[model samples]
Target chain A: MAKQFKSLHPIKFYRDYLNQNVRPDGRLLSKFRPVIVNTGSIATADGSALVRIGKTTVICGIKAELAQPKAEKPKEGFLICNVDLPPLCSSKFRPGPPSDLAQVTTRFVADLILNSGCIHLRDLCILKEKLVWCLYADLICLDYDGCLIDACLLALLTALKTVKLPSVDYDVAIDKKVVNEDEKKSILIYNTPVSTTYAIFEDKIITDPTAEEEDLSSGLITIVVKEKELCSVHKPGGSPISEEKLYDCIQETIKRADLLNTLINTAISEQTH
Target chain B: MNVIDDNNLLMRKVNCKLDILSRPDGSVLLSQGDTVVIAGVYGPIEVKTQKMLINKASVETFYRPKSGTPGIGDRLYESIIQNICETSLVSALYPRSSIVVIIQEMQNYGGIISCAVNACCFALLNSGIDMKFLVASASCALDDKGVFHLDPDKLLSDKAKANFVFVFDNIAKRIIASHTSGSFNLAQYEEALELCKKACDAIFDFYKTKMKNEIANKV
Candidate 1:
């Protein structure tokens, strides 16, 4: 049966599918899995979202807590991003502490959030240096199929869109803070940065690979597009790729970003309604 | 002791997916309402010399919280899960090897311990590991008014006077583990146990349905 062939000679099975111009999962080389986004699902957190791309599921929750602003950046607040890839997601990850992949992904997501100017930290400042809203954005991988970075970024962005901070009245002289829970305001997001991951198998470049595909491929490239500009083009040292192929990946990401923007917007609107 | 009504005995909505992760021998993501936990099983593999056992497979558990390093509370959870897995697994079949069950707490609304235990059970089943019997877990909260709330949310749990988590095996529906916090009388504890025991039945049925679907898909 085909299942036996796939398990026994996986490379040959994949090559056979590639020869026919399709993937083992019946997706075209450039086709991506359907992305479904649901926002404000976790009631305990200030903002939360569940994003699913194919079978890879990620949930992001943002908890906004009051904290004193740093001495250097008194006008800005904090946005700490952490991505957890526990052993439950994949067997490659162990049970001890955060693995290298998890730490790298967290740094990448944090860098993206900062460089993209998606959120203005100053907007989070309530009483300048006295008090500010420190948003702790924690991304958890419930299912690890593939395209982990793409799913984590999407979940964080969507969850950030749903964040609502209560109105706080701070008396500077008395240093008293009274929070009005009734009047809540959402955060201001400037740019919507969307990332797309592709696997480079020999000379063929495939987008949104599953876990199996990622392993068989030689290299991986992730293109992050924000509006018409390129936010980041990350290639974590796989096989060498030509400039033209890189440019093509950027173009594909641009198109994908537009579609994702609409998807996020519709999901947020649906949550509000 | 205040008796819980039959209408208040229902658990939260349960959702689960088995074998969702690659690389792991078996994995499961289970959610009870908004409290989600994912568990993976890697077993009958190489064991560290210091921790190796001569007559049975050593069972180990790791509990990862949503964020930051695992604290003392998390370590307690790990041990609780470790004990449950050690007892249920037929480790004598694979001597000198080890079985590791890692549970990641995705979202914690309430009753997270129960969710993690159930998720671990499902992951072990998915790994096709030999076990004495399947286990199911359920939790309930007792408010100040002595009313029992099955599968209480964060708000309810925070306001509760006591909370209880109980695990039962499928073979005899007997208690495999019991964890409780807050102040409560002996009579109240007994009533809470009875309530959770009923809720465990629903969880057991859920596992059966999910396993049947998995087999059907494979066929």
Candidate 2:
């Protein structure tokens, strides 16, 4: 009976649930779904992770290749983040070049990766201008439930944590790189930024929405938190939110970041064992 | 021939996961040694006017490289994969529609073309699309010592004199597609083809085992 009403009058159903301070998925208004992280799942990728938040599943694979450093930044390497929302991930996405949503998400994630200072590009440099590691981190959405940004960020961070690069020595005389397969080292990660997404349904704020809730909501806010500092607050052209509500979101994200940090560390440690 | 050993004939570790993505009709993440490719199949759906075929479904393929936009070499890979898929798929069964195959290159240690082709086949199988016959591909590298290395890594391939990729059908195991680079004599070419044919059989067996496991899980 509830399912029929949810399908017929989705907004009304959500309003009824919101009136009782609960969500359709039985989560409280501010409660996030359980997050599951698995690292080093793809052997081919230098670093890889599969993350699940509720029903949304995302896989991130980081492949490190040798490339010449850019002219301007001769000492730093490149970190490219791309998010793919294929037709297999959601019915709304079609088979073709990446959609607008995908492009935006890629840019947003790239910005967070660069601006957060989580990964030092200089650490990726091997031979200054001659050769450096170009990390291609590709995040593919396997299932689109909701809280996509949250899942993508977690997958990227965990995958980055698991990356191991084979030591490469440059022979100056021959101008060639000799990779030592026996010696491998992990990249230095400075910070682990976790993102939390919230949806504004009418006047009430709901956390970690599903696909159905995302559609019916009037606005969406994604907050990226690193430790106690706020890294980014992305509210893309939705209904205006109050300052206090936004502050509450950031505070909530700070707490969530601590929990996610522990989760990511445990996942990585489990893989090592 | 003198340098070729029995162990060299064995292909690298091949791993695959089917139906990994929920939205696509069929999807597979396949890894051949260190070269990994993810492929998704969507077919018998609405077709654009320009790409639609009256008698058969049009097959389209897009190959996305790891980092940058698809360049000339990437376009060449796309056409090669599209032709192979068109030949293997029974497109005539779904007329006035289209079958789209999208392959994303996740990692490339060596033999990426063969890995991508095999990944596409696995994705098609997972989608349960009608096909004339299943296809599997194998790659080998010819070194300066006149020896063939099956599933060469980046180190071997970079120092190789020539590289070869061959696709074969499961029914007759006949050649479906062949791509080669560098120069070699006719005898060397024949020898390389023979080497790849045997490797492709192992891929076919892998596919069968994967399908059997998938069925058992469902039951």
Number of clashes in every candidate structure? 0, 2
Q: Judged by lDDT against the true structure, how good is candidate 2?
A: 0.85
lDDT by residue for model 1 over A21-81, one digit each (tens)? Answer: 9998889999999999999989999999999999999999999999999999999999999
Report the poorest 10 consecutive residues by lDDT, candidate 1 chain A.
Answer: A235-244
lDDT of 2 by residue, A1-273 (tens): 988999989899999999999887788998889999999989999999999999999999999999999999999999999899999989989999877567767877887776577899999999978899999999999999998889999999999999999999997679988999889999999988888999888778898899989988866777787767656655543343454576677678877888999999999999999
In model 1, the Cα lDDT at residue B74 comes to 75
Q: Give me the iRMSD of candidate 1, please.
A: 24.7
Which sections of candidate 2 miss by over 4 Å? B1-219
Least well predicted 10-residue stretch by lDDT in candidate 1 chain B: B1-10
Q: Write the per-residue lDDT of candidate 1 for residues B70-146, one digit (tens) a residue.
A: 86557657766876887688999999999999999999999998999999999999999999888888889889999
TM-score, candidate 2, chain B alone: 0.96
Q: Ten consecutive residues with minimal summed lDDT in candidate 2 chain B?
A: B1-10
TM per prediction: 0.56, 0.56
Per-residue accuracy of model 2 over B26-114 as CA lDDT, tens digit each: 99999988899999999878999988889899998899999999764576577668867877888889999999999999999999999
The share of true interface contacts that also appear in candidate 1 amounts to 0.00
